[model samples]
Target: MHRLIRRPKSVERDLDILSSIDTKGLISRRELMRRSALFGAAATLSTFGGVLSAAGQEGGGKVTVGLDSGAFTPILKTFAPEFKAATGIEVEFASYPLGNMYDQNLLALRQGTARFDVFDFWPNFVGDFGPFLTPLEEVGTLDELNFNDIAKPFQQLNIYENKIVGVMIDGDMFINTYRTDLFENAEEQAAFKGKYGYDLAPPKGYKEYRDTAEFFTRPDQNIYGLVEVTSFFVYAFFINQLVQLGSEKGVRYGELFDAEMKPQLVNEIGEEALRRYAELTAFMPKDLAQAMPWDVGRQIFFDGRVAQANWWTDMPKGAADPKISKVAGKIKCARSFGDVTVLPYGRAVGIAGNSKNKEGAFKAIAWMQQSAQANRWVAETFEQSLMDPWRNSMFDDPKSTFPLQSESGFADNFASVSKELLASPKAYLDISIPGTNRYLASIMQHVPRAVTGQATPKEALEAMTAEFEETTETYGRDRQIAHYEEYRQRMIKQGYWS
Candidate 1:
């Protein structure tokens, strides 16, 4: 029946399992037999090895960790070896796509599978999965871990029911990553200022951002002014956008959601705030009107065909790699456009509720987040550090091995922003309202329609309100009202509404 191929991984010392499922009539009998024999050998060895490992761990042995595939792979590859050498403890890591990983972990925890010792948690779902994540309070004490070194807001973001559940391992700031070479030209700058009535510098607020986008846009030249992740809450890009633009929110971006998983805005502030999304999208690439945030949008921006763009910390590497990017050298980092209160995306590491090897998993996470390992990973990965607060402390330090900057003190430029993030409180924005996942999805889908003039702001807000109300009602009125109340307070403080 089935043809199999036998192969051994020369370097890793692992057996390969290969199967030839296709049985087309094109191949001769002798060839088929040869291929099948090879396949069968490899499959046999692979099965035998897998059996031995399973038998070895039948009772219990090591900590199993789940990581989101993609960038995390490179990060672990770079740091795991060092941690293993230093501690003599090895962490078994399982990688999967973001959606699949979360679902698998969720099911495993619910079924008490104990398939994972540690799991990655997102800020939005951190609260949702609180019941399933092992509270750090039950395992390792934070005091001994020097929890104070963790930025305050970020620390708070990980707490659920007043107990810390997740520790942010990497910090990601959202800002405009633009082509400096394009903006540096005097003629381009003059024309931009003349058309937009503002200097051709970075956008400070929503209006300014739009003006500049329109000014630089030369459809006939195949060049556009601004390129941003066109998602429903690209409006939330306004979260950082607002702060970077000099409009301070009532709550710090980091502290938007608190321990209770309640909305932190003052009133229906998100509604009006979303209006800016409707306006700004008018100037973005048309693909945003109906494309996923990470799909093709980033690739286009990194190609250098677009003038200015916005994204999280990892965007640099995405746009800078020579193989994948054309405008790498032109990309320059800057302070986020709108708010002073920095809201960094959190990469949290926590023990799984059903983990069998709690101690082992904690050891791995500790090693991963520790200053030395995290610093090295930051340097190697170039994915901003949420664990290390200093953006540039390693520039001249002899201990610093990362080759981020050629000259000394260049990192100091990031210090102010880094310090602000670390010092600011971590807010629970993404997970604040129940059904936020759907709400955010709806925003991503509908907001673009409104932004591109397919729907009016009032129409978008009305639809959002209707959906928000329905989702809240599904959760219960009392809970919804309570969240609205807290949100109202936050808005009043920020001056969104009286």
Candidate 2:
């Protein structure tokens, strides 16, 4: 994977945009929201109508939010006009490329300039923004919404230094998406069974997965068995396997660190995970080094060039879309792969403590997450977008899968598999705390080296362990150990360890 901090994330480009807009003068609420009828604004209009009616006159403000230029953009862009019309808050937004957003948001928040009111916050980076973000509990929910409604894993993520720094914004977990066309092919399946002594099907575990990958590698037919990805996505692949391998091998890495906060990333489990990851590189496209960037691999798979890849659960929506995917209607999702099918990821958002319009920002968030809007985001899509659902309500709703089902053609299959996997006992959660980013950066550096053959998996992990120790020392081992202890307690309370 490339470095965690892809670039400087300097806001020099943002400053140029800032200079053009007059922050000193507020735009008239009516004028700003005048174009509210964009993107079937029906769901929001009635909700905001009463608020606008109560104003009697123009009594609105502006709320600028920020997002990574990924999933948030399409939905946010569609909803902005309605939010503006309802609250009289001119919605101004800025999006950084997904790779650079973490550092970009950090620069903006640390500089004490609330460049955006409502900003996207990933759990892993929430600790870094502790000083600058308003705790969710401190602000209170918009309509007394129960914070308990979100899944326990996600709820656990928002707690930082005993405070709720962010709220879950999207539901994400990795799962295997493979072309059913290939797996179910009679000739291919028979050949696979003959060769590997198993039916050609979705892998129940990494071992079977490797065998399946090997059976499908046919470079001459211009078809690759898997798509290898780099950067943070690759890290997910490595760590998820490591976590799973730990249990099967009778060495659980579930707790990540021991009671003393010593990293357990250099042991047998780490070596095995790295070895499996490196082995997968052989089945990836021939043009790339080890793997392609996530976007590249995704497109390759959609074009029917690659057979399978482990990616976010939402990938099937794109794979099944007839309009864009060459392999439309041929995708299938497997909920569980014996242990954790794939790693799960969750993102949370918080209002900047220094936000110029916290009230509007809060309202915007509430509006965006409302049932209708949430459902629309799920169903309404012409392309693959982020709008990943996080709420239990969404998961339970039969109607929520329509949009995805429409695109992926596995409406029932996707829903059942996804819900089961999401609630799987083996789901892996990302590390969240002040020093995690730096520690993960240390990992990002060494693990990829091992994958590319510069170092042995054990050697790379040894270097990772040393660097992790140094980072722990730099970030105060005592404090971090306490945080891990606190997380442990939460896991116990929630049965996350069970």
Candidate 3:
């Protein structure tokens, strides 16, 4: 037998009035906070109360969330209590390693275990887990979730088969981070122009990027020209170059696959992209073949040992932090080399299809992704949270901009470059069809072989192409074709392509 606890009548009345005031926009968030504090409602009410009421789950309950271990673990834990206060709901998290998170979540969802009410995962995983996830629209209205405030590129990421399946939580794209001190030095600039017959600045094309990388390689001084993730996830780097190459040639869908669902990676463009990617190894760390993005690649840049690195959006925040970075105040950001940039590994949150409390779960997700919360997360230093700005409001909000502004122009440069990248017609979406992980794994396997000289670029891509076909066929070629076509259509609709 269980005992039921209830809120006092006065506390319940205060919460109702607070919820009404918030819903009607009678006060600003700060003012609401002030009023709640004055009424002593801060101990029992949170801003989430309105969202819970909107979801028709204003009563108390508990929902379990599934999350991968990392920066998000601490953030969610810190906010859980606030959520509980607002709606009288408890948030229990089941954390898993990043690598196994997909498998674990998939297993539980498919098993109908109701193990998790919400799942926080990479946007691409929506393809594999769509069947087991609840459509967000069913739980709350778009306005209630503040859906339109999210970035355009990430908006498409949260949809599956024309239905809203998730809420964008982390905005991610590969951007170039370089040593400002090196690039601004007059001697280096003149020497670069004399040698390369072009101005010394951030690279505008692949050839220029290669030239820049080669020109900056000074191993004796412990400074390398370039570094990027080159390990198991090297596929992301390869795809970035591949998409840029395809966009340059004005090919649709970045030439990843054809209308017939045949992979295009065995062609001349594929070989060239692979070769160009492998060529950069000469100017990178000798152990580049096995380097992971976060551990080896980012650490090298933060240590001021790399002249330039193309990494995730969070790189600038880390670079600006004096506590963990040797390059603080000396770093500058630019869009990755190309007419197009690749958006990769962004995370989103979705309610589980098997959840007993879908409304409660969505309320939790909405609360986390609300503009104020997202802005706060973006305002925090990278060491505090890995979340990047995913909402338009976050970009313009003073709270979010002030911290980055104080970092000596990092905020302005990052915000400008990020807005351009996220809104560009040349922005390429990562493949998010079913079996996306497997297809990318195939690239991960062979790209390293070429980088290590175990195989030629052409040979490595040929093998990867074959494996891609097998993966597509294994999942049923016709079915995969439809999924890819649907995904392409969404990308085009979202202005990612023509």
Candidate 4:
């Protein structure tokens, strides 16, 4: 049978390994075998008592999931057998690479082939996927699941046009984490105060953040201030930084667009955000543009080469792993240094509108969020896991932390990460109207252009605006405007924007 997930020809179903491709595109044999061993070691039987499984499931030969290749995939492998034993439902995953998953899922779901029962998606693309997904609330058996426990910002993403279409799977947002060893050093503190007129600490706002980054730069020592992944989620670095420019007064769409759906890319805030976004690359490796954004960036910090790295809860979590990080106990998680910290992109898995088995699919999605399950994934002894702590309760487990980190206690050390999550009183949802892919695509293609100084920030924004307008026109101007208006109003109602 043909498979949707692209994998090695020699790799087989029974092999039991977690795999990854390097930047050069060669597969490492040792890493694959290592992860496979961990997969066997980490999983536990579900004590969900039938609530997570399909006690009332319909015909269940196999239930397919349109999944992305991420840390979460391996976690699912651990539980798949338990789910099968409980519900008699075999799990088949039709997977794709991270960036490619959205387009492939769209292709699979749009056909009448019943290709996927459920698909993983980001909030930013809800508009495109909205039509293809079933309102999860409409699925009767899922009613008892506590919908309110999810973070409000995430709640904003899953509810589109007032219908709950997806389950909150990833609380992927930006949070600045810094080297406490640097910040707490008396000599560095005196030097920072002497140079910048302030005590060295985690920054509370934008200017301080830039200054803090600048203060830590020491290229002669091979130490730089900050590094952000340039290749994939660079767009997030763009959005979150720009959003902070207007965050204090509660800007509606941040720099996404004005109330009129006009692109706001050429403004003062836009230029500064772009400049600051590019400015950090100065202290990074010459190949900063090629650096892996999330997990691997942790290594750059642990090596003591950089003072700060920020994005996603996963970074701080993974940084605490003793086996991998030399600076494991030295990092501290904190709030965005500026105003807004909104959803630039996040994962929210949902049942396909065209799925032949909506009930079984909902069960699987719900299963992942069960309190016990959520904690296991977040606190999984392995340093790198598929998902982050999306639920508030994930942090409630006081004892769930690295073995070496028990000295400070998990609660005290983790306060910063959790506080960062709730710090943003307001955040903008990614524009989720039709042609969202086109809308974002227009903007993303210019990220490296403007940041690398190849294009003036103005030129980049103008180029993006042109593309945005073309996409808007192609999607029908008036219809999209109405949709945009509806979206803004909904965000206001949901308190995403004041």
Best lDDT goes to which candidate?
3
lDDT by residue (192-259, candidate 4, tens digit) is 99998878889888778788878888878877787777766667777777777767535554646566
Model 2 weakest 10-residue run by lDDT:
32-41
Clashing residue pairs found in predicted model 2: 1-231, 71-386, 379-403
Task: Return the lDDT, model 1, position 318.
Answer: 54
Model 2 per-residue lDDT at 185: 95
lDDT of 3 by residue, 1-498 (tens): 999988788877876666565433323557555545433453224454544454334545789988888857777776665566555577888888988877888888887568899988888787888888899888888887898898877777856777888887888888888888999899999999999888999987888889999999998998999887788668778888888887777776365888788989888789888888888888987765455555678888889989998878777778888889999888888888998868888888888888999888987887777665566556655766788778887666533443644547677777787777877777777777789888888988999889888999889988988999999999999988888898888777766687
- How close is every model to the real structure, measured as TM-score? 0.72, 0.85, 0.87, 0.84
How much does each candidate deviate from the true structure in C-alpha RMSD? 12.3, 10.5, 8.3, 10.1
Clashing pairs in 4: 71-386, 72-386
Best by TM-score: 3
**Which stretches of candidate 3 lie above 4 Å from their native place?**
1-59, 289-293, 398-407
Off by over 4 Å in 1: 1-60, 143-146, 232-235, 238-272, 287-289, 320-324, 340-344, 381-402, 407-417, 420-429, 432-434, 452-454, 477-498
All models: lDDT?
0.55, 0.70, 0.78, 0.68
Give lDDT tens digits, candidate 2, residues 247-336.
687554466789898988777777878888788888877677364677788888889987887777567767777787898788887854
Cα deviation at 354, candidate 2, in Å, is: 1.5
Q: Identify the superior model by lDDT, candidate 2 or candidate 3.
A: 3
Model 4 RMSD, rounded to 1 decimal: 10.1
